[model samples]
Target chain A: MHDLDVLGVIFILGLTCYAMRAGGYVLAASMRDDGIAARFLRLAPGNLFIAFIVGGCLSGGLAGLVGTMVALVTMAVTAREWVALSAGFGAAIATSAIAP
Target chain B: MTAAGFRRGLVAALPFLLSNGAAGLVMGLTYKGLGLGASHAILFSLLVYSATAQAITLSMWASPLPVAAMVVACIATNSRYLLMGAHLRQLFGGLAPRKILLSLFLLADASWLMTSSDADRNGPDAGYLLGSSIPMAIGWVGGTALAYAAPLATNGPLKLAAALLPTMFIATLLPSQWKNAASPWPWLISAVVALLVSHFVDPSWSMLIGGGCGTLVSMMERTDA
Candidate 1:
């Protein structure tokens, strides 16, 4: 494809992304704060985050699993993100080296 | 819009410079391998600004690009943002809409998680949200440009480790999301459902489906109780 066509495609995709990012906020603005929709929104983040972790772990395999566990434990213990992330990265790299 | 919150957020997000930069470097290498020029690759990273969307779209890239299908795939993969945005409204409802909307441009999963956790403790600070998001954007866009220019030959283990960063970052937030006895049930359900959905359907849809199902169960449990 030509450079211009690629740019056009990227632009369109960008618009689509921004729309999704903004769409729910705009729609939610009109809803009653105490409604069921609000309840669902309140309950959604944790579930969504859990699902993300599961999907990520499954795709990432054992190394991913171990790394995430280490990260979670580190966070739980230290409450430091940088420490957890560094530890997790180290664990994942070590696991990958051993297994791969 | 407190400068203090913004400064704290920026400092807190400094770690993403390493995590996001590593992941973005891998993406840049992939884009280069796909024959994309530096300008195009950088633009894609800037405009799309989503690792999941860009990764999925890259899998579908071909000559006479499948524009319609790509758009559909992008929507499907990014649908989580809709839920996130809705929840953001609940958190930052009192903030100026224009400011919120502009800040949403740089919103990312890690930054969103960080902002949500912060809000739970410090109340909603739009400045923190915007502040944290900036470094993530920089790490991603700058890393792409840097990788394109350098094209470093990264090894397998190093790349795998880098790829795990986002997930690891999210994993760190899991503790804060826990509410009480009921939290574990929904989280377990979400994990099981996500695993099944990822196995059966497209992996991209797993989070929305699994998370939605879990949330429904939580609501039903609440009603029953």
Candidate 2:
């Protein structure tokens, strides 16, 4: 790709993403009406990465599944949020080499 | 601070931390796999301060240009955070400039989701929003360090990491305003898009695009109806 082309993409992208975040919060205030469009975009904490769980299991096998399960259960029981994260993450790597 | 606000910031952020930390582990594994030592992995986690980007970078480290490309790509991928930051500007607005800068460095999609979720769930409280950031940063650093220190010691299936984090996060943003559709759909849509894009697009910017696309399409369809 030409240098100018690359620079243009980067510039546009940086502008777009920054704009999205800024716009999201700023526009959030005037969002008094629950029009269909606003409601759709206002969907909180959009599920961006859950597909990774399925993909990980499909590729990584039972060990990966177990790792996922461990994390889920931990989240359920503790509800502590961040501190409980390592359990499932820890399981994924340890089991990566294991057959099961 | 409301309990839900605290939980919203911490709980909702879990899925993000899981993905990020696990991505960090993958980087660590790759760094070790490359015979480049864990220091590269640790430094990447601490300094570069991104998960999937770091994972891509670990592979590219052998050829430094690729790493540069990865940085460009990843920054573009998660550039939405800039937008998220803009939305968050109101939270720490009254604080001194230094505090806002400190807040900005720790701010990420996951943390912001949690904090906003808290605010939405419990009415706007700038103090709660700021308070939530404290633990959020700790979790990220601690999670990364743990993963970096011992890759094998890392547990959980990638799915669990993926789901659990978002699950907690989505849970925080709950008590919804929209009854017709689920909030988690955006996340689910993004994940599926990431799965597809991971196959074709460069890893850096694909997921964020996927997410933005998901949010936009859903809303556009609603508007058109």
Candidate 3:
């Protein structure tokens, strides 16, 4: 087992994550039931999705990200989730491991 | 709803299973790479499943950076939780506090989207979210085990597998939002903001800002309309 501070560490680590999720929660609450913010909150998934992809693929750099994109394109065409995920993650692990 | 609701939840979670599993698997392998065990990786995923956050936290292992700094950084990065928890109130509006907290842990981009879409389509997916996320929790553990045991750091095919998270998310989320939109504004706005983030922000910090920007844009448009 890890030290007693692992969760503490994770909590600190995950705080930013909690903040983002919480952003939705807090903002959603401050708005009226049928208000504009409420509608915007409802539409958030699309924006968040694009942001997540950009962060994951591009932040990692071009080679793996590009390869990952090819894989995503394949998955989109096929509509096969497992296939694309495998290609993206597999490419990352392999490239990182072999980088010299 | 019927038992088919559970089935539908399963189908909706399929992409998450792959992405989360791959991510959990990668974290496990990273744990091993840093001389930690697969168990460490599994435990982390079981407890905290956020991929970007996990990657940031785990990178602490590869550096001389203070572990304490890593912890603080992760918290800063993940501070968006207030939003996720708050939004969930809409879905689980009248639920007990315990259920709220329980759902809070399972809630993320995938779970939120699945739940929201299900609710929009079926109106309140209290039972469905639980059905969907429990399986996802299991998948994370199992996949973490695979990555830990195999540790596919150099494995080309496996890396490709892990790359699917963002794409899968995009595939499902885009259609759901735009399928109901009356104009091209939302899609166009989302693309421009996402592209700007990709160009300007660190990939790590961009998700939060991009999400925030999108919400802000949508809020203004909705107000003016």
What DockQ do the predictions score, one after another? 0.47, 0.18, 0.34
lDDT of 1 by residue, B15-46 (tens): 89877886678678767767889899999999
Clashes of 1: 0
Proportion of native contacts present in model 2: 0.21
Q: Which ten residues in a row have the lowest lDDT in candidate 1 chain B?
A: B174-183
lDDT of 2 by residue, A1-100 (tens): 3434433433444344334444545454554334553454444223333433444444446655666566666666675544345676576657665664
Q: Residues B69-187, candidate 2, lDDT per residue (tens digit)?
A: 44454444354554565466555444444444444545555567766776666665545554555555455455545654763532445333443332233232222322434444555
Is 1 or 3 the stronger prediction by lDDT? Answer: 1
The number of clashing residue pairs in each candidate reads 0, 31, 56
**Cα lDDT of model 3 by residue, B114-212, tens digit:** 877888888775667666776677667777788756626833443343343434334433444454344556545655666686678444345556656
Q: What's the TM-score of each model vs. the native?
A: 0.65, 0.47, 0.57
Root-mean-square deviation of candidate 1: 5.7
- What's model 3's TM-score? 0.57
Model 2 chain B: ten consecutive residues of lowest lDDT: B169-178
How displaced is residue B54 in candidate 2, in Å? 5.5
lDDT of all predictions, in order shown?
0.78, 0.48, 0.56
Question: How far is B160's C-alpha from truth in model 3 (Å)?
Answer: 10
Model 2, position B184: C-alpha lDDT score: 48
